[model samples]
Each structure stands twice: as C-alpha cells, then as structure tokens.
Target chain A: MRLKTRPSHREKQLSEDKNFLHRFGYAQELLRDMGGFSNFAISFSIISILTGAVSLYGHGLTYGGTGMMGFGWPLVALFCMMVAASMAELASAIPTAGALYHWASLLGNKRWGWYTAWINLIGQIGIVAGIDYSVAFFADGLLSPVLGYRMTETTTLIIFALVLVSHGVLNHVGIRIVARLNDFSAWYHLGVVLILVVSLAGFGKGELQPVDSLFRLGETFSDKPYWLAFLIGLLQAQWTFTGYDASAHTIEETIHPRVRAPWGIFSSVAFSFVAGMIMLAFVTLSIQDVHAAVSADNPFIFVISQALGSTFGQVVLWMIVLAMWFCGLSSVTSFSRMMYAFARDRGMPRSDWFARINKHYRTPVAAIWLAVILSFILALTDYFIKLVNPDTTYTTLAFLTGVSVVGLYVSYGIPIWLRLIAESKGRFTPRHLGPWNLGKWGRTVAILALLWIAIISVVMVIPPNQNAGIALIMMMIVLLIMDLTYYRHHFPGPEAALQVSPEELARREAEFHD
Target chain B: MTMLGVLLILAACAVALAIGIIANRNVRAFNEETHESFLGDRKERDAFEDPSVS
Candidate 1:
C-alpha cells in the first residue's frame, strides 16, 4: 500500500464543504429560490387547514370561545387573529429553522441570538408534544368503540404509538411527498367538515337558539369572572391558528423562498381564519343545548351523533379523527425539521444524530423519530396522572402548548424589533418584497402585533383556578428544568450565525470580485 | 368475527410496509447514484444546481 499524502489547504477546504453538504443533504437553494406566488398560497393553505380544523371543532369555537366572553367573543376572534396574520407574514419572509429566534439573532446584537433560538426551540417541542397527544385523545375516542375497548391509559398509549410510527414513516418519505399529501389533507379536511356540518345543520332536530342570547358575554352561571372566560377563549383562538408558521420551517426546501414562503405563511393564516370561523358558526348552530353540550366529552362528536345517529355519525367522527392525525403528523414533521436544522448548527445536544438525514428517504428521519419518541413519552404522562385522578387525566396539554405559542410570538417580535433597530443604525436595510411592499403599513402592523402577542402571553399563563395556577407554575418549572439540562451547557455559541452585517458581506463580495 | 377485521388490518399493514421497504431501498440507490454523479470529482456540472437540491 502507498503512503497517504497530507491534504493540501484547498483540499482540506473542499473536504469540509463536502462533509457539510453530505451531512445536510445537497444545499437546498431555497433561500434564494422558491416556487411562484401560487405555490406559496397552495402550500400555506394546505398546512393551515390541516393545523386549524382539528382545534376549531375539538376546542376552539365552543369551549375556547366560551372562555373569552369579555372581549366580545366574535370580535376578539377577529382582532387577535388579524394580529396573528400580520405576524405570520413577517415570519414567512424570513423563513428559517431558527425561524423567529434566528431572525432575532440576525437582526439584534449577536449576543441575543443563541438565547432566542433556545426559547423558540423549547416552545416548538412543547407544541409538538401537545399536537401529538391530542391525536391520542381523538384516536382513543374513535378506536374505543371499534376495538371494543375502554378509554384506559394503555389504549391511549397504543393510539399514540400507532400515530407516532405512521408519522415517522410518512415524514421519512420526503418533503415533496409530504407537501403533496398536505395538499390532499387540506382539501379533504375542508370537504369532510363542509359535508358533515352542512348535513348535520340541515337534518338536525335541535331547535335553534338566538345568537344574541348565546353570546351574551356577561351572562354567568357561577362565581367565575366573565373576563376569565373571554381570556380563555382568546387562548383557544391562538392555539387553533398557532402553527401556520410551518411554511417558514420549509423555507430552506422551497424554491424562491423569501417571497413564496411569506405568501404561504400569510395565506395559511387567512384561509384557516375563514374556514375556522365557518366551522365554529356551524357547530354553534348545530348544538342541541349550547351550555350543556360544550362541557360534554367530545362535544363536536356529540353534536354529530345527535344529528345523524350513531352509525353515520361514527363514520364522520372517524374521518375527523383521521384528519386530526394527519394534522398532528404534519405538525410533527415541521417541528422535527426545525429541530434538525438547529441541531445541525450545533445549537442542540446530539447535534450529529439530530442533524443526520436519511440517505434513503432524503428526509430527516432521525429528528422525526426523536420528536415522535419524545411525544410518546409525554403522552404517557397523561395516562399516569389521569390514573390517579380520573377527572385530571384530560388536563389541557394544549394550554402548555399555548405557552409555547406565546413563546413563538415573542420569538417573532424580538426579531422584528431588532431588524427595525438594525435599520435605524444603518446596519440593516429592508429587503425588497417586489411591488407588494407593506411600506409604512409594515411598521404600524409590526408594532401592534408585538404588543398584542406579549399581552396574550401573560393572559395565557393566568390560572383558570387555584389548581390551574399551580399547574401552570409547575409546567414552567418542568420546561426550565429540561432547558437547563440540554441547552445550558452550550449556553451560547461562537457568534458567527448571528452576524448579518450587510457591510461585511458586501466588502467580502467586492474583494472576491477583485 | 371482528377478529377477521383485525387480520385484514394486519394484512393491509404488511402490504404497505412491503411497498415502503421497496421504495426506501430504491430511493437510497437513487440518492447514492445522484451523489456520485453530481458531486463526484469525475462528473462535470450539468447546467447548474438542481432547484430541488437545497
């Protein structure tokens, strides 16, 4: 055998580049290239409908609305959602896995980027766990009767396992396939919900109640404050519309990302708002007794079953359950990609493992599975807790998810402010969005959205009861404990990823040209 | 019997899994070929970077 030669300096550089490309898969030139406006609209619409529909029926319209009575339930839905829409637009334009956190780092002083990404990452995983566990709840409801089994913790685990595996396999299939499937899921969800809601409304036997009486914000049966209910409703709306930033996570994979990604993000939010409003209206109209029905287990299912008998109703319920699984799976897929992107940058523990792509699937299989396993474990916590107290087992995992949503918005707001600050100092210039510039409107909208999200975050953590207060506190503790273990070691990084100095990059380009 | 239903479910899952395994293997082969063809020192650039190759 011949002796190996030492690598030349250029060879060493080439080798490092090759290794990086191999690790991350081929450079998806998505940052500079993305599909047309239509593709953005379609993809965003798909993801939004998938994420939105499950929450609308399961929680948003009825229970969530009931909680936000003080803010004029319907009007609150309208105003808060408009802010969310503007925020989504901002997130879309700067789509990256670091997402809002990365944007914050890029726009702000370099010192803040690492901590911001950490917060966003923590929030994202919490949302993944929440969405996945909800699938368990919905699946358990559908399968219990079909399998001739009761709603035990074991059955819930099985439900979570099947979904986790299906999602893992599907995510392994790659982004193009996932986007196509999401397209089907979006239209399928709309079709199913439209058919079910219309059919139930037309054939339903329940006498219609007056909207004015039903929405009377101050009408209270107990000592609970009316404002408390409204605050809860706002939280629900936020949850229902929360994950539309999914488009931002896929920006690296999209073609012509800056423009298209923003469109996707905004369209998903706008479409979901419309579709969700309709679904909420239909469910509100379909209820037999609004007050009593909202409190029932699977209230939407109850409304369907009451209107269409057990046989036909169960079919519709099962369809919704399946759609919910698709939603959860899609959400998890986005969540894993975000984690993979961050970990690839050595921003997370097990960066090598987390960042690894499946050569076969052209997907982040390792990250996808990691997300699933974590979610599965979280789902088990519900079963264990509920075993001790039957009533408590069905606690709001989504509320914890709401905390993450607030975290996401804060991540978003931080970046927007930093970008503005950088612009003021002449260190950053606003990127062109072609002729569709928000112009002066961008500044006004951005400020309003940031303030609104901050307020919502505080409202979300307010305990529903003394017990809920304690629960919220403990949840924060758990999140903090987890963060310390994984992220605290590398509390920050060497500070290059955060450097978005326009002048420096410009100078480098000039030198290279010379 | 519903046991029949269970068996049918298992059979469907088997069929799906088989297809997935075959598909996964084929994709792996394709990626390996692509990596060799595009990034391989022997191969010249074909036009430019693929739009989908992020």
Candidate 2:
C-alpha cells in the first residue's frame, strides 16, 4: 500500500517566481556617500551598548543561572555579537534600504515580502522611540540624582526638543560629519567606560564581593526562582543588542559599503560583546549588592562613588553623562537614516516630504526632523509616566522596547531562514565572502541565533507585571492605529513593484556581465 | 568557567588568528599578482553587484 504524495503549500508558493522580481534603483553610488567601516562600527556600537545601561533595571535576570552566570552578562554580550556577525554577512550581500524585508523578498515569495517590511517597520519605529525615551531616562538620571531636583514633564519635553533639533542639524550637514562624529564617539565612549570600570574595580573602597556571590544574588531580592533569573537576563541581553545593524540601515551613504558595511555591523557587534563582557565582569566582581545598586539610584555611579569617593566619582559621572549624550545622538543618526530609507521606498507616510534630501548637505534632513519630533513626543510621554509612577517608569519603557526588539529579530530571521532554505536547494552560494566565511557553520549559527531571538521575543512581550501587561496592550493598540490610519494609506505598495522590465534587466546583465 | 564562556574565549582567539592570517594572505596575493599591498581591482569592483559568482 503506497501512500499518495501530498502536495506541499510552501512548494507551490516557491514555484511562483513571476511575483518574485524586485525593484533595484539603489545605485552603487549610494555606498560612496557612507563614510567607511570604522564609522559604521561606531554608529552601531554607540546605539546598542550605550542604552544597555538600563540592564540594571533587570539585573535579576542574570542572578541565578550559573556561578559563571554571575558573569553571564558578558557571555550574553558575546552571543549578541555573534548574532550581529551573522546578520552582517547577509546585509553586505544585499545592500538595500529595505534591508531584511528586501532580503526576504529576494529569497522567498512576494506575498511574504510586504509582511516582512511591515514587521521591520514596526521594529525600526519602536527602536527610535526606545532610543529617544532612553535619552530622557538617562538625562533624568543625571539631573534628578545629582541636582536633587525632580524632573518635570516640561524638563523632559525640553530635553527631547533640544536633542531632536541637534539631530536634525547634524544630519543636515551630510555623511562626512556624521561619520567623523561617530568615530569620535567610539573612542570617547570606550575610553570613558574603561576609566569608570577600572576605577571602580581598583579604587572602590567598598567590601569587594566574589563573583560567586552573584550566582544566588536574586535570593536576596525577592526569593525569585532560577528560571525567572535566566528569563530576565535573556531579555537584558536582547536589549543590549538592539541596534547592531546601524551600518546595514545606512549602506546608502557609506563608501565602498558593499565590503565595508557588513564589516561595520559584524565588527561593532564583536567589539561591543567583548568590551561589554569585560566591563560586566569587572562590575560584577566589584558590585556591593545587586539589588541595592540597581535600584532607583544610579547603580554604576553608586558603585563608583563607593569605590572612588565623590571627587573622582564626580569625574566618572560626568564622563558617563557625556557617553549617554553621544550614545543618544548617534542613535538619532541611525534612526533618522532608517526612517529616511523607509520613507524613500514609499513604505511610509508623506514619502515625498520625508524622503526629500537637502541638495547642499545631501542628507535626509526632512526625515531626520520628523524622527526627532516623534521621538521628542515619545520622550514627553515617558516623562509623564515617570512622574506619575517613578518606581515603574524605567522598567516599563525598557520592557516596551524589549517587546519591540522582537520585531527586529523576526525581521532578521525571516530573510535568513529564506536564504537557508534556498541554499539547501543550491539556489544560493556566497563565493565572495572571502575569509569571513563561516561555511556550513553560518547556517547553524544563524538558526541558533534565530531560535534565541524568537524565545526572548516571546518572553519580552509577556508582561512582567499586571500593570505592564495593561500598558503593553494599550501601546500595541495605539501603534496599530497609527500605522493603519497614517502609514498604510500613504505607503506606495511594494516599492519593489517599480521593476525594471525584462528588457532592461537583460541589457544591464549583458552589459555588466563581461 | 561555564561551557559558553570557555567556548567563547576560544572562539574569540580563533577569530583573531583567522583575521590575521587572512590579512597576510590578502597582502601576499596582491603582491604576487600585482606587486602592491593594495589589491582592489576594477574587475573586482565590476564583480561587486553579483558576488555569488566571484
């Protein structure tokens, strides 16, 4: 009794290549405007690890997994970096503003392409909001603690406005300045953080705790279980890695970016992971009490103060303040670029206006300003929330951002999975990846990274508390409404629909092939 | 150390060595092929659009 073969739905979809042709207007010249590999790395690192300072909000996550888990924060950093490296290779191959969505379209059916773009759009916008809100949170952190002044809604508004305007002006000046600034930020950020970590480790007068003590640290917090700690740390790690693809988003503006942009994404992520791990290890070894330190107080600052006294601590504090500013400002650069790209594709509202470039500066000044305003608005809302409920403020925003990051990982994974499937069928092979090649291991690592991202995404959106749950639902509703009403109506469907006909494709193929 | 940590440290070292080796290979290849440390070629640039075949 031979069983009849069942027709597979996905196979049917794959056979429909008529719907798979893509729009390819982005010229190689776009890459020339982008600074270089180092600038790309700096942009990515600045946006990703800087805001991860909020991990103090969820330190319980790292508390119980292993004696090694005490220092697992750094390992988490390493994992995030590995994920970035995998993503970088793919981005280098397909240097498009649409990024992951376009990648999905290239490797899979057309129907999935629109949905992929939607998911990525959601993630990118959420990141912008998250970064802007982080700016407010960190700014509030400095003013509130040191000045002993309560941060008002107005203050947050003022901070947001100033930052937005500054971001707008910087983007207006074009790529060279942005790249230079990013380079400066990379060194400044690392140098300052290094000083802070070393000072805390070597000079802190507080009773030093062994790294082993952090293993059961959550026991002292609220008697949480081991799984809870592991869960929290997973979320924290995801947060730290939220923007490791800043280079991918701005490939349109980089020089020789086809080769260098991927390096930027992979290398920056690699640097962040290694550097972050070392920093976390030192901090964990030097921490007084995980619970007390990560409290409403400036945890790292608290540690530094205990170790180095007010004078030296003050200097470190100033450095941290500058770092946060640079981090926030650099994020503006990335977010604005993402916004401009989305707008350019007519995947967003007011594409004509938002996608417009300043002729002299050759930057998307309009999109930059739009992002700045929206970010400012989000920051103002965050400030109001904080004023209403100080205890839940930071955690709430962090959790929201975490949920949004899920959208990013999903965006990254779908394209990769499509590529993996294609490769299995001998439809894809990367011959020019050179020594950066991971071979079969690339697929394995990518799949692992995808699984990790999927698990954490689910964990993040689950809501840690009843209040958080309610807020999450409301935020989703608001975001959906905004997208449907404003963006959906305005978006020119499937930017890839602007296809060069078979004739043009043939001409270009023949002309370029030899 | 945990498996992850030990593995990561080893991986990092391996990656560093691989990069060094690749850099050396690139330099040598360029020198042998074209008598220069810089190896970028117009043909290579032409191949940029479709790297799958290179």
Candidate 3:
C-alpha cells in the first residue's frame, strides 16, 4: 500500500546518541560529531610517544641503560595493553564523560567512584603540569643555545604559562577546533617519528651502537641494585603510557561512543607501542656514548645532534618540541573534560560553575581555565625548586611523573577490580555488559592488569620520588576526611543523574537546543 | 653475566608474548551488538518510569 512513510531522519544515530545519554540521566550538553578516528586521535595525541619518550629518554638511560628502552618498554606496554582492553570493556558498557568514575560507581558503589574521581583529578593535574613543564624545560635544553636566549627557571616558567594559556583558549572555544588539532597532531607525531628514524639511520651509519647494545642493562647513575634500578626505570614506559584514558573522558563528544570509544582507548595504546619502539630503537642506537647521552641537558636531542651534527640536530629538536606543544594542547582538552564531568555531579567545590557548558561553544570554559591555573601553579615548582637547588630538581620531575602514572593506574585499577569481583559473584557477565567482551579471559586479563598496576604503583614511588609516596598517602587521608565529613552528607554521586524521568531528560536536553 | 643478560631480555620478551596472546583475543570488538542493560540499575529504571528527577 502507498501509505505515507514517516519522514526518515537522515541521522538515526543522533537520536540513539541522545537516548543513550538520557539513559544515564544526563542531557547531551557537549556536541557530538567525533567519528571513530577522532575518538582515537584524542587518546593518541595525549599519549604522544614523542612527548614522553623523548622527555624521559635520559631517565631510562640512567637507571637501566638502553635495555629499558628495548625490553622495559614492551614489558610495560604489554601490561598497559591489558589495562586498555579491560578499560575498553567498561567504556563500551557505560559510555559517558567521567567514564572511569561512573564505571566504579555502577560496578561497586558511590565510594569507589568518589575515590576514582579525586584520584583521577590529581593524575590529570599532575599530567597537565608535567606535559607543559616538560615542553618548557625540553625547549630550554634544546633551543637556548640556538635561539640565543637563556631558559632560566624564571624564563621557562614564563614560557610554561604562555603555553598553558594558548591551550586553555583553544579548548575554551570548542571541541571542533581541538578535535581537528588532535587529528593533525596524531599525523604530526607519526611523521616526525618516521623522519627521525630515517634521518638518524642515514646519518648514523658508522656512529650507531651495535644492535645487541639495546639489551645491555646497568645502573650507571643510581647505586641501587641492578634489578631495583631497572624496576624504577620501568616508570619511564608507564609515564608514557599514561593519559590514553582521554578517549573515555571524551565519550560524550564522540559519535557511537559505546563502540567507538573502546576502539579509541585500545588502538591508541597499540599504535603508540609499535611507533614508540621504532622511534626509540633508532634514537638509542644512534647514541655514541651512553654516559654522555645520559648526563646531557637533553639526552634525546644530544644523541641526534651527535649523529647528524649541530645544525641538523637543532632542526630535528625544533620538530620534536612542536610535537610536545601539540601534546600539551591535547592534554589540556582531556584534563578539563575530566574536571567538568566530575563537577557535573557536585564532585568538586563550586560544582555549579565548573559544570556549566558554554552555550555558544558547547565547551567547559570554567573547567578549562581551572585546569590551566592548577597546572600553572604546579609547574611553578620547577622554578622554585631550581632556585633553591638546581641539582635536585630532576627528583621533583620524577615525582610529577610518578604521581601521574601511579594515580591514573590506581583509578583504572579500581573499576577493573570491582567489575571482576562483581562478575565472580555472578552479578553480570561480560557478554551482557558491553560489546567489548573478554569472555572467558576476563578473570585472567583482569588479574594480570591488576597485578601490573600493583607492581608499578610500588616501584614508581620508591627512593628519589618518595615525596610522591608521601603526597599520595596524605592526599588519600585528606580525601577520606573530606568525604566522611562533607561529601558523605551532601554528594549523591553520579547515579543521581540517572534518577531523572524520560520526560524530564527530554526537557533537560531541550535546553541545549539552538 | 652475558647469560643472565640474555635471560633477562628473554624473560621480558616472554612476558610480552604471553600478554600478546591474550591481547589478540581482546582486539577491536566494534561492529558487535552490545546488551541493552547499560542503565541496568533497578532503582534507576524506576526513576525513568516515575514522574520526577531526584
């Protein structure tokens, strides 16, 4: 029969996206046009192999020689892949902003989510500080001579502020610009890696270390036992592996988030592992003297300069610095979104302001500035510490690096652990929860991931970074006090968002309509 | 010393290989249908049916 057909919506997916978010009792405030690649792009940009691998290249060389770059990297990447896969399953099941916090809440209780949110926030703050500060210090180390300017502590702090502000403004405007930049960033990072690998290989024909040199392990700087020092150096890979959770944080802005977000989380880590290996292989092989490279102001740049001469090294160093800039910009986007999502449910002080999305931009403007401010303050530690004792400042850098890796891993571990316990008691099956099921391997993978996290959490906080260990314990105690006295009486948790009716959710979403 | 070094390298490689086997099984679960119990909380479902948002 020639009956009138209902006008088919060109985008059936938009309706489904809104429906999914409504099921969680929140309106889709952030705009969502992010395709699968864009979803992958955010996480990859944050991982930024060039950013972390190069910045911490000297750390790895000092603690475990070159073996950590060769062996320790894959070892940590293996565990990180397991972590990413496990997280992908949760992200697929409950695709939302603040996905880690919500996963813990639903899997266990509000307490788990509360702890996860605060710890994740701390990690984000540390990462934002670390990434921006690294760019400043790395730039200072590589370009001070070339640019004919000094990057003293005060000067570098100023540079850090300028970098943080640009990222804040870019993120405050909208996700569209940030997403485009991240996509470009992903390509920029890989292209630079390719160029460096090829250039170093061509230039370093006779200068490169033997291939077997990659497996050579020792503790040249620290007097710790070889095994212990190697364990500490593994922190380098863990630090590089941080922030892939950016994919989960941006779920609301991603199209088909349940499927796409999980892919984003896992694929970013997978790609980074391979690409980072190749880049590190060439860079480390090009090192003529491990001791000199390890002791240099900027070891990664030193190796390149040694191989390809000062001029070529300076050009390559500039390229790497640009990648770090992109890396920091993406970190700001990820960090601010986590803050906004946590605030959405009164998880922070003055939640009303932080949670508000700008009408014109559909971006979290207040949260973006909050991230920038917090990181800027934290970045000042370098200036103050260097002013006091420049010799011990790298220890402070190690603390920041430790805080980020340990904090994020703790947050990631909680949900996976809680989910495992729930499934063991037959609360739910992996098949029923999400599209990304581990099936029978759920227990084994979860256990392995939990074990990996436990080991690194301890190893990362040892010796020189004991300040991080103290900070973490104190942070936990303070959060517990705050929760027991304040949040317990007031905060109803993310589950409160889901207490809305279908009609009410529709009305709330309508508020975002143009 | 050389033998121990080879063993350390091999042990790390072995760990990666074992993890890789599990990782393969966990690859790219897109294009699969997810179960509809995401907002599976019984209380939350009642909230959806009820007239108010708490």
Question: lDDT, candidate 1, residue A244?
Answer: 58
Whose DockQ is higher: candidate 1's or candidate 3's? 3
> What tens-digit string does per-residue lDDT give for candidate 1 at B1-54?
224323433443343244334323332333222221111111222111422111
User: Would you list the rank order by TM-score, best first?
Assistant: 3, 2, 1
> lDDT per residue, candidate 1, A329-395, as tens digits?
6777667777777665577667889877665455777888887776666556545656777775225
Ranked by DockQ from best down, the candidates are 3, 2, 1
Give the range where candidate 1 chain A is weakest over 10 consecutive residues by summed lDDT.
A24-33
Pairs with steric clashes in candidate 2: A31-A254, A33-A253, A34-A253, A34-A254, A34-A255, A61-A233, A204-A307, A205-A307
* Residue A441 lDDT (model 3): 69
Chain A (alone) TM-scores for all candidate structures: 0.79, 0.80, 0.95
Prediction 2 TM-score vs. true? 0.76
**Which whole-number lDDT from 0 to 100 does residue A334 have in model 1?**
69
The regions of model 1 sitting more than 4 angstroms off are A1-26, A29-95, A211-214, A220-223, A387-394, A424-426, A431-437, A465-514, B1-54
- When just chain B is superposed on the true chain B, each candidate scores a TM-score of 0.51, 0.51, 0.46
Interface RMSD score of each model: 20.4, 12.7, 8.0
State TM-scores per candidate: 0.73, 0.76, 0.91
Model 1 whole-model lDDT (C-alpha atoms): 0.54
